[model samples]
Target chain A: MSTRWLAQPERGNRRLIRLLTWITLKLGRPVARWLLYPICLYFLLFSGRTQRISREYLQRILKRPAGWRDVFRHYHAFASTIHDRVYLLSGRHRYFDIRIEGASALHAILAQKRGCILLGSHLGSFEVLRAHGLFDQQLPITVIMHEAAASNLNAVLHSLHPEIRDHIIPPGTPDTMLAVKERLDQGEMVGILGDRVFGDEKGMTCDFLGKPRMFPEGPFLLAALLQVPVVLFFGLYQGGRQYDIHFEPLADSIHLDRVRRSETLRPWIERYVSRLEHYCRLYPYNWFNFYDLTDDARPSHTAV
Target chain B: MASSPQLGFTTASGLEQDLAKLIVDSLRLEVAPGDIDPAAPLFGDGLGLDSIDMLEIALAVSKRYAVELRSENRAALASLRALAAHIAQQRTS
Candidate 1:
C-alpha cells in the first residue's frame, strides 16, 4: 500500500499553531470560530493538493460532481471539529449539543468487565469521545496511534490538555502490545483507527465507497490475539455545535485460523468498511481522510 | 547444560533453543534459530523485531508453554535467555 500519507508534511508551523491555540483559549469559542472562515479560505486557495483531494472524495461519495461550495463545506466541517477540540480538551463539552446513540450497548459491554476494542476511523471528531471518557461514565479509553504522523499538530493539541498524553499508546514500540493487553485485562476500552495503513504493516483491500481500499491489518490482528470483543464508533459532526456519537457492537470475538488468516479477516474488514461507507453516505461531509484512499498500486488479493 | 539426548551438541540450553525456534518460526524471520544471540536484545537493533513480533512471540509462548507474558514483566523480553528463564520460572511456579 502507498505510504504517501506518512510523508505528508504538517501545513502550519508550531508558532502559528500555538498562536491559534492561544487565540481560541483567550477569546472564547464564539470569537475564536470566526477565525476558521479566513483560515479555511486560505487553505482552499493555497492547498491545491488538499483541495483537489477534497473535491474528488466529495464527488465519489456524493454521487455528483462536487462544486467549490461542497468542497468548502467539507473543509469547514473538518475545521469545526478541530476548533471544537480546544473546548473538548479544555473540558468545555457543555457548550455543544453532543448526542450519543447506542451508548447503552457500550455500557452493557463495559459492565461485563471484559474490555472490547472501540474501532473508529477518520470519519469525525475523536475528541468528542475523549470528552465522553473524561466527563461522562469515566470510561478508561486509551488511544493507539502513530504519533509521528502529525507531530506538529499533536504537539500543539497535547499542550492544550497535558493529561491526554498519558492516554496515548504509540504502536511499533516493543511495549505497545503488552500495554494494550494490560489495559484490556483491566477492562479498559482501547480505541484504534483502522482505516489507514502505516509502515510495512499488512493491509487488506476491501470494497469501500465503490472502490477497493486498503486497511491496516494490525488492529484486527491485535484483536484476534487479545481475544476481545470489537465495537465500532463514529463521532459525526452534525454541524452548528451538534455532535452525534454512535456506537455499535462489531464482533464478540475475532478468531482468525492460522491457515485461513486472510479469509477470516476479509468479512470483518468488509463489514467495517461497509459500516463506514453507510455513515459516509449518511453524512458525506464528515469523512476526514484528506488523501486518495483508492489510488493504491498494490494488486488486490482475493481470499483463498 | 552440556548436551541433550534429543538433539546434538548445541550452545543454547533446551529452553532457550525452543524459544529461539519459536521466535524465528512465528515471525518468519530469515535467520536460522541458532544464529540468534541468546544474550542480545530480541527487539530493536538486535533481532530487528517490532511490537507485532513481540505479540507474535507472546502468542506462541502462551500456546506452547502455557505461560502468560505481561507488560509488567518487560524485563523478560530483554533477550532470548531472559525470555526462556521467565518461561521456565513461570512454568515451575
Candidate 2:
C-alpha cells in the first residue's frame, strides 16, 4: 500500500513535506526524541513481515543467545534510527551534536581536483552526506543505489529533496555509467552504497563479518578505469541525535597494469568491511540490511 | 570421480581435495569432500546450491587460496573446476 504512495504524484505533497522539514528544523532533536515511541509502535503493528525479518537477521548476525529484551531493543532502535534520519536531512545535525573525525581527509582529497569514490554503507544515516554536501559546497557527489521498491515515505522525501533524488543513480543501463564517468572527468566524487545487492553477478566476493557476502565492485572498478583515488567514508549514528563521520584513504591514485589494478581493489574492500564491522558490533540494531533475501517476505508488488 | 587423496594422489589432485574440504567446512555443508564427486554438479543435480550458496563458497575459496575473485570472473559454468584451477595456481605461486 505504501508503495502506491511512492509512485503518487508529488505536487500535492511538495508543500506539505517542505513545511515538515521546516517544522523539524525548528523543533530541535531533544523534543524530537518523543516521536520515536509512536514510530516504534507503527513498525511493531504495521510491518509484521519486516519486523520478523529484522529479528531473524539480528539473531543470525549476533550468533548468540538473545532474550526478548534484546530483540525488543533492536526493534526500538531500528525505529528510532529511521526517525532520526528524517530529522537529519532537515538540518538536525547543525543543532544537535555530531562528532566528525575525518572531514579534513575528505577535504584533502577534494583539494586534489581529481575524481574520488566515497563508499558508505547502510549502517547509519547516509543522509549525513547531505549536510556535508550543502555546507562544504565541494565536489558534487553521485550516489549509486537501487531504486526503492517500496516505501512511499522515502519516495516523498526523495521528491521533496530533489538534491538527493537527482544525484542518486539507479542500477543498470549505460546512462548512469556515462553520468558517473562525466562526474569523474569533471573532478568530482561519486558515492555508493556498497553493501546492498543489485542481484547481479557484477560484484566481488567479500567476507562480511565472518560470512561471505557479495558486495558491489562497480565503484572500485570505476575508480580503476578513471584512475581516481578511492576514499572510504563512515557515517554512524551515535546516541541521542548524534553522528560520527569518519574517512580513510583506501588508495592513492596510481598507474597500474590490469592485473595490479584489480588486486588493488582488495584493500578498499577490506577497509570498508573493517569499518562496517566496528559499527555493526556496537549498534547491531541500526544495520538494517535483510541479509538473507529469502527472509524478506515483504508483500510483493503483484500482491499490492 | 576425484582421484582419492584418502589413499594416495597426485599433488595437484591433493590441492583439489584440500579445497573441497575447505568448501565443505566453510559452508558447513552436510556432505563430505570425498562424498562430493568432483565431476558432479554443484547446482540442481548434485548439491542443489543456488547463487547465494555459490557466493558463500566463493568467499571461502578466496580466503583460503589467497586469491581474489574479481567482478569479471563470475559465471555459473566456472563453478568447482574454475575454483579448483584458481586455488592450484595460487598455491603454486
Per-prediction TM-score: 0.86, 0.62
**lDDT per residue (tens digit) for residues A1-304 in model 1:** 1112112324346677778889999999889999989877776677777778788889898889999899889988988888888788888888899899988999899888889899999899888998779766578898986452356666777677787877788776677888888888899999988787765567888887878888877778888978888999999999988999999999888998876787888889889998999999998999887757666643221100
Which digits, one per residue and each the tens of the lDDT, describe model 2 over residues A177-292? Answer: 55565566678888877676453324566677666766665666566555788887777767666677777777776443544544766767667787778778876776756445
Which candidate number has the best DockQ? 1
TM-score of chain B of each: 0.86, 0.70
lDDT of 1 by residue, B1-93 (tens): 222223322443887987788788877789999999999999888888777679888878887777888877889999999998898778667
lDDT of 2 at B58: 54
Model 1 chain B lDDT-worst window of ten: B1-10
